[model samples]
Target: MSTIPTTAVAIEPLSISDRLSLVWRIPLLVIRCAANFASFCLSNGEIARLDWRQKLAHAYLRASRVTLTRKQQAQQRKLLTGPRIQGYCHRYNLEHRAVSVNNDTLYKKRDIPTPVLHFVKNPTTQPDGPTIFYLHGGGYHNPIKEQGHIPLALQFAAACKAKQVVFLEYSLSPEQQYPCQLIQAVAGLRYLLEQEAVQAENIVLVGDSAGGHLTASLLTHIVHPSPYAPPIDLRGRQLKAVLLVSPWMAMSEEQIKVLPRAPNDFLTRESIVRFSNMFKPGLNEVWSNRCDMHDAVAVWKKLFPTSHEHAICRKAMLAVGTSEVLLDSCVSFALECMGCETIYVNGQSDLRLVKEADFVLAIAPGEAHVQPGMDCALGYHDGKMMKAISTFLEAC
Candidate 1:
């Protein structure tokens, strides 16, 4: 049989003019606005670490424009399809060529390095080496955290004094969808189990946004096995703790609008549907154009059959802005997961010490879900979230 032509090949570009304002326009606009704002947020002091992305975003902004001034037009041309962007991307590759670590201790504070079993070396630490499985977030399709995040990951590993780290490079979307990414994450965990690096009790799973969602999903999966579940060989590795920051917990369109409105929110309502559709093809179509076959409002239910979240590993934290639509869903998912409890970190609510049972705390400063300084991402909160993570990594 002839291979079926993919919808992506047959469908038109996901443009701002597309209908179902939530699906394409919202995400595209937010991304563009974030890029444009990134242009504005650039500083000379941190030019090396930050300027390139700002420049890239600016370039994309320029490419996205129609008519422009000489400078603007020049910038767009350079950014849209130029060697400057390519050069920047190339430099990034060389820098990450060897992800080696300095053996010298940076500080002797309480840090937990739950090294991943797959990457651990026995220059020889006992089975007691700390283990942390990391998950990166980028609205399901974006995984370009090599620069701004790798350093932080290295530091996190060093802080934990872990021998190995499991950085999950989960699948991308527009093709792959719900449970798919979660399934891969579970597979990564099982990889650790197979390597015999650590046990469930020694493992600390860390994730931000979409990563967090997968972490939650993984936890949910193991606690409640499905026919689609991957076999778990938990002989040596014990799944201990989980940490999520501004996690994208809910897939329903109703929850997408929960996020606090910011100038450049990383996630928009429509993008949620776009990604949702990515998982369950025929899930939901961008409303900009009327799809005779899809509907975003109830599209989510049609995508994933499991509405009730399964309880898996115990929770360390599930932090989000009250303004974020996913907040309530995160809370509900944790609460519903029977055995799992969550630390409700509030961005718009009180940042007090919640009970630390199966629960934890938050430190939102009335900022957006993942704002720049507070968040490593353009609009997310990885920076501030790290503080919470350090506390968790040290606590137990």
Candidate 2:
């Protein structure tokens, strides 16, 4: 996608007044978008009172046309200038167990297609178990910085006693756009499938926010290509499970209205709008062709470009916060998973409907938007969240 502005409307930096207008005006479009979105959250009685027409009208006022180029640049710059996120080392003083860490390959090479850096943690004997294909989230813009998500991955590795954990640093949004990110995700998973006789059922795809959305997308579009979807071989590449936190699954005019808009905290409606434009700065040409959610034929066509690949569906955990604006949509989307085996409940999700779900748990303190590890920074209760997640994964 080109970085040049498509509109000749004299591109000028937004000013205070201009931003104010945007703050008020943009909500209309978002609200309109939200109205059209399918509501799997409200029950038959609750939905009866839900005002669809009003939500639809409001979303229209805030929606902006998706741009092509500038979005890519913004996301790129943010990623380049972000802080060096470092995970806590397992150098035990009195907290967690102390273990010797050895991963000299950390930052050894950057040009590699996929870089798996090590996190500082007590080195437990590697367990003979399934592997985890970890995908970090950055709203399609930034990804887990070098060693950023290491702490979380290391914890999972210890609990599962897995042989290996591959952190696929897929190119972020904006620059990579839709297909590019999906391409790498598919390629990365496929690479693992080919390298070893790994059972598709043993591999878990883990992530949060945009990572969760990408996970859902991979399930929706990859196995079955839409008219606009690119070509990819998704044969025999199975997954054991999908673990997502506060995953941003569906994006449309309707869903945007109901998105969380808190600031400097979990998710904010305002920031989401801003970042939404920043990432995927341009629409994927492939998506334009077969992008039909409302159309039954289109959705069917979009979902399956080829014969059923027979990819065994994985058990999934879709966790969210109680106050999350996306709470409704997230749970709805989870239920719609073509072959969802299990759905673990989060406090946020339970606030809505609890159907076809296995278990529901309360939200931990200080738990903000979809964070996998390093909850201590946010003052979140680590033991409760992680223990529940691990238990759910182990049960299946």
Candidate 3:
């Protein structure tokens, strides 16, 4: 049996000097963006191939990436949280319930804020249908976007014909790190199972980017509990499905820099590195090098050690854009899940077997990082990727 890597490291908070450096870095980044824009106009490159809206979005993302530090991002999240929730309730005509999960012993010991499970009440949902537990992705530092994440979750709930969508508003990073978010996530699911009497088989765990990391972590924790987190036993229950959208699997800066760059992708290596550093501050070599969740086969094996032991889930879907910075890692993770021994570097056809494995890996052509979710958030649902996801969920 393969041993899971230990993540026992002290929390290293950013120093005063590191925070102050952002003042100078912001202006420098603006200047760099201006230069890049000039070059982009001159060359018929990848950026030129993108549609007008994509181009505009990419430019905005590049500018904002460096300007807003994690601290500022957290502050912005607080301001937007109230309005975003209210907007979703009004627009979707769904009832909102902010259920608190703070009674857990770990939370009280750590003095962590009560994590709120934002339940989106969908009246048309079938009582026996799946219940989605969504974890929004903002590199673990930013809050769930009103325009982006909420709509995307609702779109997924609609596609799956789920009864209701529950969003775990897990605590943000820098302010709260690593096991804290993981603990809150476990607590949220426990609340669903114990308090609400929701059966494990009826739940579908869905997350994108950093939220994807948390989702995977939750599964890992169930198989082998984390040292710092509160203990949780699934009672031999398995989830209906797990949907990982453009998951941020690679945690190290070295890993990020080594991956092939995607010119059209808005997510940058520097931004990812910064977010990762803030999320898991001081890490030992094992923890810093890779996220154990990337080894899907090992996780699956440990999760279902014997035939009598239940599998983690009945179905799993990993959706990634061809043009994402995290594309390579996502593909590697998919391959692991599919139990492929031989590597296929250039051949996309080999991945077709993924469907047969009960683990689907959907690749969106010419799209960039979580584009399906972004499109849904932006009120555009014509993408084939969205249809693929809906079909996968419907079949489940």
Candidate 4:
């Protein structure tokens, strides 16, 4: 086999702020971890009375606040023009991994390229297995190269038993607008089918956060064509499944109030507004199509104005947190997937309900955006969460 190309980038030295954050955060995190362990050791009834859940939730919130505050400072510097900003880019890498360590190809706009990372248990000895076309989420701004993301991707690849995890690094936003990423996503999928010789049914499209929305949009296009966007020649390429993690389905201002914000949710309303505007800028064509949970069907109808591609009933899995702000929208979208009426989960409710339709819903309690995957990899969930995902992949 050909040697895997280097995709990992160089690791930068930790900044003062990073060290400061760690100095304080690490101790607190250790305390929280110990508390969590204690909670786990206790019986369910005893644990509830001891209120370990609340303690864990509060600890997470505190940590999230610290990270968010630091990130905001970095975001402000994003508008600056100087070596400082350049250094910041190099330091944060826009959350991408260093290009020095990875084996995936880096695609640029001119190349009509799609960055793909293949993970197998044994690269030299393994056989061709299932394909997971992973679209990562960063509100359309972050790339998969972010810290820990490569390992996270590998973890997902392992969980799903994929021989090759084709990560479609569609162009990021603000630099590339709405349909650009969508178009790139379609192109990437088609290229995988045509160039890679991967079968449609063997491929599972997986996405998280904004990536989930892109994955859903791509599905709509494949099953139902939109004249507004250029057509992709799918040629009846059906996928094994579409796994969405905390997908941001819609961006209505009204949604701000419709769903009560999670006390510990990391994403802020202001952050969402800022990024959404940055993504589309002046145009509302695709932005207007954002769903409100209940509008999943409507959004689908609008996107696929002609015949509905019923082939979307193939298989799907949506993993979301009960405490996530997008919980309502996810439920609504899940309802649409089941071809049933929308049912909104109350903000105060932490009920872990698993419903079956054309898709499966994996609800993690007291969790926020992308935490399950992160937690699973970091050993926060004790492998249970990853195992659940592995089971979902097997079922698919």
Alpha carbon lDDT of each predicted model: 0.44, 0.47, 0.69, 0.54
Model 3, residue pairs in steric clash: none
RMSD of each: 13.4, 12.0, 7.6, 8.4
Predicted structure 1: clash tally: 39
TM-scores of the models, in the order given: 0.56, 0.58, 0.78, 0.66
* Model 4 ranges with Cα > 4 A deviation: 1-126, 145-148, 227-230, 281-288, 291-310, 337-358, 380-385
Candidate 2: misplaced stretches above 4 Å? 1-122, 125-127, 145-148, 226-237, 260-265, 281-311, 338-367, 371-384
> Per-residue CA lDDT of candidate 2, range 1-396, in tens?
011110111224656775675567556646545643333123242222323432222222123332112432233334331122222332332122111111224212222122222222245625567777677676766546433355566566665666666655555544435555554555555555655556677777777677776665555555455432244454645466667766775465445766555321335565566557655522333232213335533443334222224433434566654435566566655444332333333443533322233333324232345534434222332333455565555554
Of 1 and 2, the candidate ahead on TM-score is 2
The TM-score measured for candidate 3 stands at 0.78
The true-structure Cα RMSD of candidate 1 reads: 13.4
Candidate numbers, best TM-score first, in rank order: 3, 4, 2, 1
Go through the candidates in order and give the clash count of each.
Answer: 39, 26, 0, 13
Residue-wise C-alpha lDDT for candidate 1, range 74-103, written one tens digit per residue: 222121111221233355442211121111
Worst 10 residues of 4 by lDDT: 95-104
